[model samples]
Target: MRSITSRRNVIMKAIVVFIITGLLTIPGYTLAGTSNISSNGTPHHPAFVESRDDLVNVQVAHRSSPSHPMAPNTADVNIIELLQQLNEPLILGYLENLTSFGPRETGTPSCDQAAHYIFDTFQNMGLVVRYHNYTDATVSGSNVEATLYGNDTTNIFIICGHYDSVAAGPGADDDGSGVAAVLAAAEIMRNYDFDHTVRFVAFSGEEQGLIGSYHYVQDAYNSNESIVAVLNADMIGFTATGSDGIVGKIFENPASEWIVSFTQDISVIYSDYIGIQLFPQGETWGSDHYYFWEYGYDAVFYHEYHFNDYYHSANDTIDRMNITYSTRFSRLILATLAQMAQQPVQQRPVLEISSISGGLGVTAQINNIGDANASDVKATILITGGLFNLINVQSTSEQTVLNAQGSMQSKAMVFRLGKILITVAADASNADQVTKQATGFLLGPFVLEVVIAP
Candidate 1:
């Protein structure tokens, strides 16, 4: 393993002299490869084997890679490392403190202690924190909020989890995992600078039908807060099932497809899970994210995607959690926040021509209205009734370049997402045409027609 100092040096070099063009021109690639294509007939480059299947394809019923060589360049995020170090222990300690308070049921004494603990932690992080207080029947609780102002309030990114634990279960996997993830993310994010404001929130009364979250959402609406996305981490700590009856699952709310997709993209490089699982059923109304989604804000929930058999049981203790998994999961959240905090709000492509056909080769163009550029242009040409579906990519085409100037075009294909829709995005750093160039550019959507006869 390389020393931290060595890693820092490489990272500095990559930052100082990283040529975007050269990085895109590696030879015999397996990861994300960039290329320049020529329409004029020429010898074709060999396609490298895919390292993973496209998750978007699995979710949206479509999906779509490459390599280039350059002088050895490396980078390590010291901030990420430092943040991880600072937040990991803080999270463990927070969990310990919560355990001390006992099971935090809605309107219970333990719940109040947990709430105050979260609020104080936010204040300690040097954030401008507040509470969205409300009541349900006899119970009154608040959604703790911590804000770090950025360039604009209209561009807001929220990271949240529920702090309240269940009564009979102790609620370790149910939410203690999520609360830990949120606290850790907050501690790390507090030290960073972003172009958009970031909100770190912990809601109480989630297990009791999202009362706390509902109150917070109403508060946001009343205050006219411009929330772009809500990243709800609920039950992220439970990573394993022991022989004594433990169920561990990871959940990413389906409503948060965009957020999930972006997170998964980064996870491909930084985390253990390569198969980015999207579309895991509808919102269960189990966590805080549902409140945000219900109120018209884009929201996604994150958790292990299985059942914790010890759920709602006293055995749902912290010892059963995969600490190593939790630690890595925290890092994944860190990387995602770092990347997203720097990005403009995400925007899906406006489908111009849903389907196009010509038995002969046809072209498609999709527009991206978001400030960020779209890359990893995957055009899946499927033969509806035939036994063939052609996959074409402009990100690796030597002749096709989809820059901020215009939509990327494929070398007119005969069989496309036949009578079907296609999706495009920045799948890799090499294919990110909008990196710095897309900082302020609002490119158009991908408009393409498919071939029905051919």
Candidate 2:
């Protein structure tokens, strides 16, 4: 548990972001999967949580964490080399070109030109690319997708951002930022080796209720595709204070909770570059991630931490955003995709915590159950329970290493309160860069708070 003052401070920051941001939803196509339904039988996307409003729950999710929630180790994994290939000048050029095309409104000629630019860019990267063109009575839009295949084609990992905007603005911040990330990631990641497929997509008609994503998901369902996850970025360049700070939210649904957790862990590993702050927003109404979540797929939504005041307006232009921030976010995107594509550890290290007797010192055991060496193994503990659950419970971390089939142990003295909860988490990585985490909770009889009637 955290202090009320600290929690309230974060929530105050979150209220401002939702007020002026365009979100992206995830998975759904013409597939046979069932959409989530509420008790009233109305179609509902299981909203996850709120931005900073749900930070407490987010902390709880990380409380019983996995060793390697993300397949590969949390190390840099050649991602920095790939990120180095990210040409900021090129990204600026792309944003400039995209913004100059004016508002790429759904079904407009301007939008089509932007589509051609992306399509051509992907071709130059030598990726397997194509166009997802959609038509309605009013307007037609094209969604550009580029593919970099890995050893496992069945497990498709997608990263995308909407390209279209409202008819009023240039949309440099609303979406051009995200599109810029996609463009940059594509150019750099094309040279990498991945174990799973990567699809870099630029969606159109997003301002008109995620039309392009909906259309693509429909076809994807009809084609019977294996979509492991959809990582969507929208409005990621807008930093209210305009510094190098990379403030953003990691949004996902209940089924996709792992995505959020994994992302938070990944961000910690790359905190120097991404600096991403997690706000587990369960119910996000707008953007591409919504559609993916609707269709029963694991998806994640990335957006700026602070909302842009000129959102969805003509004033939305490249000059208003911090391009350096976008560069860092794009770098994190490729790194995450590459990490997920890495091969899994056949022999994973398992960490366990046991022997809880309040003040009785707790023990954490690490077993390198995998066939490789586990390096930089760390175990952490946190205990909170006192008068009003506020006191110096216990917080400590220990580190070590374990070879194949080897085991180790660490113990920390814990204070026993009338009723307290203990959180034990361990993280370790194999020599091959495959990582894993183990977490457990020892709960004492403690009721948090009263539930109010809705």
Candidate 2, residue 171: how far the Cα is off, in Å:
0.6
Measured by TM-score, how close is model 1 to the native structure?
0.57
lDDT against the true structure, per candidate, is: 0.54, 0.65
* Candidate 1 structure quality by residue, lDDT tens digits, 345-397: 43333212223323234333443333334455443222111112223223222
Q: Residue 243 in model 1: shift from native, Å?
A: 13
- Scored by lDDT, the top model is 2
**Top candidate (TM-score):** 2
- The CA lDDT at 150 in model 2 is 86
TM for every model, in the order presented, reads: 0.57, 0.61
List ranges where model 2 is wrong by over 4 Å: 1-72, 242-244, 345-454
